[model samples]
Target: MDAGAPSEGWPLDDRGVAYGDGLFETVLVRDGAPRLWEYHLARLARGCRVLGIPMPAEHELERPLAQAGEGVMVLKLIVTRGSGGRGYAPPAAPAPRLRWQLSPLVPDAARWKVGVRVRHCRLRLGLQPALAGLKHLNRLENVLARGEWSEADIAEGLLCDGEERLVEATCMNLFWQRGGRLETPRLDRCGVAGTLRAVLLERLPIAEVDAAPGVLAVAEAVWLGNSVQGLWPVARLDGAGGEALQRWTIGAVHRRLQAVAHEPLGYPTRLDD
Candidate 1:
């Protein structure tokens, strides 16, 4: 593995840059060890198989991760089908390129403890089952949704699909409690299957369903989560016009799941006042 500078130049015709033909993973590193390492690799491998890109050996990826040293940081790994092809068609034999960069991570302690404010996005995600769960390079939809809000207090925007089914947040998977049951959107048709969501699915009894946005209004509680931020309880949900649509109080359920994520992701545990 090469610890080359992230500023190094790549060919302009690289498939990842030309047509967004690539996969990437954002890993959280703490004290020189990456959290959810296997899960991240598994997701990357799945994406490579789907995109027909070659998957590099685990040892090659581990060297960069081990160099994170002490303190918290984020490591972004990108794998692309190296430059060379005819028009839109890929080359007969593709050589994959692997690049990784590490940077310091600052924890959001206040948001984790007091919860965050979120709003529904007007932009809807288009369905593509083939690329549904992979964190591929194409992210225009998320970029647009995130741009919908510029308020410093609004932490995230909830995205739904064209079919009116709530999908996920701009950058995280969403979960809510309603009717005495824990439910999350079904990502089979669209949305990124976040690593932390994968971990909770294995350890908890949450159900995946195709539900409408109205469910959130009646939900007992709502939360948005990802590998890097762990879990953030949703204190309020607003509409595009800034109308309060739903609200939740930070409670036991939030702390319970925080405890579950704390072990793997190192999120700080907080007690209810």
Candidate 2:
């Protein structure tokens, strides 16, 4: 891949664009360096395993990654099982396709300062245990949910499973704080198991719990997290027609999580820097 041209574009018969049959990772780059690189690769590898797509070696991507991530940006890596036959059956010995790009990242400083307002999405994520947590290309549910709201103030939309259990936000993982502890939705059934969520689970007092329909109403604080944006404190959550349903204050725990997010990821420079 060329530095100027990240992709040759996908073939018309590519499985990824065809049936949403691939996985992707969005990594953060800061000052010409990639952040949390190993974790990103691990997540992409896991996604490949679950999808039956062969994982490419890290060295195969180093050049292009270094080229694209020449500055602060979002580097997206996609692995498809290549172009395949028509219908559901893939090629027996399918060639895997790798594509990547780096796009300029615009920080949401206002939300980071005053906190973000989220609304409940009308669209519910369907349960697919096999695909859950993979960050795969099948994201029509997210697209619909994201399109549900157009207000400038509503930073994100929360989604639930078919059973009305909280899954996650349109683009990030959900975390609720109570009694100085953090609890997040279990993604075994659905939702992406975010890379930042993984780091928090390993380093913080966070638990995986089932988020019932009204769980957020009683929580003291709520936050949305992903690798790129770090953590976004949720000041309010609302339902359709902009009806106020739950409100949370940006409390000590929120600040603590922000600190944890900024903590060095064993890198010379801070990951959040």
Candidate 3:
């Protein structure tokens, strides 16, 4: 797998493109090694089991992952149900297609250190418990939510469900500290269960809860995170019309979590740097 050409041949009628029948994993590769490899695979396997898509062998992925080479890069792997019968019907015997690409990781040190301003998106995610936490290919809801704002200063947007219960950000998982308690949105109804979120759940005393968007007003600190970008503290949150909803200064709790993330995940320790 050359850096210039990361993907294999893609068929025209592949189900991944036609019906969005596939799962993807974005892995962070540092110094020719993939970070959180097993967690990513576990999530992928879970998605495969849920969607009835056959899981590819570990060796099949290891080969291309090894070619990611040195320096920091992002490895995007896609496994689709392959070409199937016309329309929504899947093939009796499926041959899953594994496509992958490697690209240079973008730097987000400024956002990580100084914190970012986020907005609340008007777009609400629909409930689908069966497909709640899988990284599936149907991401139009996220696509539209992310497009709600184009301001350079607004780093991300927070999304809610139809009932106005906070779910997650457009691309990252949501977390916050309130009264010295760490809490994150419950993804059992919808939203992607990010690999980094899983790691934090295992390592920290975080609690998963269902709360309304108004809960942020009382939060001590807010955060948005993903596997690739680490964690970003929220300096401010704005409404749909750009009205200030809440604000905060990046404090000790964020730094403490960054320290915990740094050791196992390789996030920068000195965020102010």
Off by over 4 Å in 3: 1-5
Q: lDDT tens string, model 3, 1-273? A: 111235456788889899999999999888888888899999999999999988988887766767877888998988899988898988878889888888998768888888999999999999999999999999999999989989999999999999899999999999998899999999999999999999999999999999999899999888998889898999999998899988898978788877666555676877765
Better of 1 and 2 by TM-score: 1
Which lDDT values do the candidates have, in the order given?
0.88, 0.80, 0.88
Per-residue CA lDDT of model 1 for 19-61, tens digit only, reads: 8898899999999899999999999999999998878789777
Q: After superposing candidate 1, which stretches have Cα over 4 Å from the reference? A: 1-5
TM-score attained by model 2 = 0.92
Per-candidate total of colliding backbone pairs: 0, 0, 0
- Models 1 onward score TM values of 0.96, 0.92, 0.96
Worst 10-residue lDDT window for candidate 1 reads 1-10
